[model samples]
Target: MSRTNIDIDDELVTMAMRLYNLRTKREAVNYALRQLVGDPMTLEEALAMKGVGWEGDLDAIKGGGPIEDLDDIDLDLLPQDLGDLDARDDR
Candidate 1:
């Protein structure tokens, strides 16, 4: 809880706040620091995460099955040439 003043980008801070759903700049900064330093979860916390279940299709999420070789990959299924993303209307 040491208070320090330093020059920081407001836009970056705002983007961090939105991305992490943090209420304050302090929270966003702290979260970013934690992520940068690699925050390790405790054993209890890791065990607790086991209770969280996934109800989605596992195979579909895994792209059919285990990719053992590069030759097995379907070239047609992959994105061909996504040129000039700025010209896209979806954004």
Candidate 2:
């Protein structure tokens, strides 16, 4: 790791530490840097999902039904085990 002396706002660092749940200033700074330069998916990739695994009815949902409508939904229809989607290589 390369070390360099630089000035940074103490309040901002403290906020970052709390927000990111990081312990040290170094960890906070590194986490911030990684977030700043992280590889985000393109719009095309996001649009490609096309509600592949969604069990809900998109048309009925589009009507913006009352919150009480949620009660009618079968709890069993929902995913039982949502294994780490973040760690999926297909993404």
Candidate 3:
């Protein structure tokens, strides 16, 4: 590791320390850098990993198939009243 002087925000460092559970500023900085620079993945790897456990229909999206529109939903089937949502009678 090479030693270098750089200006960093105190609030950001403290936040990173709490989020990453790091003790020192150095550890927090390193963890934050690693998070910013994530591991690279190829398109083939990403596509191959798709539909592992997904239950949705892939054919609907593929071959430019007709997409379902949600604008024709029946709102009357929904509940009319939410009972006892707020028990506290403070006005």
Candidate 4:
């Protein structure tokens, strides 16, 4: 195999090493390339997934369990404020 050298920022390299538990740049790049092969638009069997991605259910609840009937229930018990967020710091 042919050998090649690529340059990258030291900060990014350090971050990648900590995030991926990799001690080398070659290992990080190999893992990144492998993850790009997964297709996000492919059709899959419903039973094949135990906890895969899913949209809003038609006849079910949002956070699991049975359906919540909204016939005569009060809906004013939810929080509507972003309270204590001072500001977003742009590092």
Q: Provide the overall lDDT of each model, using Cα atoms, as 2-decimal numbers.
A: 0.74, 0.72, 0.65, 0.55
The lDDT of model 1 is: 0.74
Query: Candidate 2's residue-wise lDDT over 1-91, tens digit each?
Result: 9998989889979988886567999998887776669857457635755577667665564455555776676566556688767767743
Best by TM-score: 1
Ranking 3 against 4 by lDDT, winner: 3
The pairs that clash in candidate 1 are: none
Best by lDDT: 1
Q: Model 1: number of clashes? A: 0
lDDT of 3 by residue, 1-91 (tens): 9988999889879987775467999998876666568955557646756666555444443435443666544445444464666744632
- Structural RMSD, model 4: 10.6
Where's the lowest-lDDT run of ten residues in candidate 3?
A: 58-67
Tens-place lDDT digits, model 4, residues 1-91: 4678878667766777677567798776665555578635323323444465444443333335443776533334333364545643522
Candidate 1 vs candidate 2: which has greater lDDT? 1
TM-score computed on alpha carbons, candidate 3: 0.42
Clash counts for all predictions: 0, 0, 0, 0
Q: Look at candidate 2 and tell me the lDDT of residue 41.
A: 48
Q: Give the clashing pairs for model 4.
A: none
User: What TM-score would you give candidate 2 relative to the actual structure?
Assistant: 0.42
Q: Estimate each model's TM-score.
A: 0.45, 0.42, 0.42, 0.36
Which of 2 and 3 is ahead in lDDT? 2
- Model 4 — which ten-residue stretch has the worst lDDT? 39-48
